[model samples]
Target: MGLSDGFARPLPTLVFAVAAALSMAGLELAVKQIALGTAYAVWVGIGAALTVGWAMATGVEPASPLKLLFIAGIVGCAAGLKLLPSGGSAAED
Candidate 1:
């Protein structure tokens, strides 16, 4: 599907995207402030729980071990991003 299919009007799409980003960023900061270690783990666990909930809500079958592993990879990357020193940046992987 194309972007046009998703948005009959641009304003609603932009508004929704901003709202979603703000909410998720708040969650991330809350998790970070609660102690990054425990917070990060809780964030990963919460992410997995949310993915499972999303699949069920959308009537998708529970994925297999390989798929779960791939999902874990993504969560791991997010965790890795948090682990980098506050001012640290990277070039290419």
Candidate 2:
């Protein structure tokens, strides 16, 4: 569901509401075990990409070359976030 009509309609509203709640719980759990930046990046990036994919699959939105490229970009950014080194430097004795 798109932002404007996510909860404006009845059926989709319930579905989206449940999905959002689940996503929040997952984010909370992830933050406890990983860096906040990493967790947040993964959360938002994956969520957005999945939402786009779902929309396209359901015919709610049309799939175009540019949209596919954007999906790729989002996944790439999430990967980059996971690969980046944390700020903590190695301690020397």
Candidate 3:
């Protein structure tokens, strides 16, 4: 989103660059404590949901009940991933 907007304005381009760098740094730190797959999925899911929510809130995108529901689902799933026990065996005796 910022990337697309950045094409029209210069400030957004700088903001996008900074945001991207911060996001990557956070992800790198997250992987140190969380499983790579879980960390990545949660990261992407929350990011996407927030992006869409922001677009809708800002009137850049049309808001719909279905879209809101999906966004809630993404957030819920990310929360679930966070709740799961870390480094647990798939099978137990």
Candidate 4:
């Protein structure tokens, strides 16, 4: 029960880090397609929802109120992104 023996005596966390890096490629492609405004919004929303879904899908936990709350926050972020001024506007600021 120590901090340095999680995976065979400090077996590197490199695998996880590498996966994270590769994952970014797909993420970046998705974001680039639908435009940062919409793509990012959808990505965040989907990510949150899917995370909970995956947890449940794997029999970790059942759906709950907290999941609904995250969805709401996702919606709010989408709306805010839309309402906010997008960069590279024609008018000087």
lDDT of each candidate versus the true structure: 0.63, 0.85, 0.85, 0.62
| TM-scores for every candidate against the unseen true structure | 0.41, 0.71, 0.81, 0.44
In model 2, what is the error at residue 24, expressed in angstroms?
0.7
lDDT of 2 at 6: 45
Write model 4 residue lDDT over 7-86, tens digit each, in one string: 45433455545545755665688665445766666666666666667677877877778876876787678656555545
Show pairs that collide, candidate 4: none
After superposing candidate 4, which stretches have Cα over 4 Å from the reference? Answer: 1-19, 64-93
Per-residue lDDT value at 33 in model 1: 59
TM-score sort, best first: 3, 2, 4, 1
- Candidates 1 and 4: which is better by TM-score? 4
Candidate 1 wrong stretches, greater than 4 Å = 1-22, 25-49, 56-59, 90-93
**lDDT digits (tens) for residues 19-73 of candidate 1:** 5686578677966555566566656665675557567566675667786677677
Q: Candidate 2, clashing residue pairs? A: none
Model 3: per-residue Cα lDDT over 11-61, one tens digit each: 777777777898899889878878999999989998899889989999999
| Model 3 CA deviation exceeding 4 Å by range | 1-8, 89-93
Model with the higher TM-score, candidate 1 or 2: 2
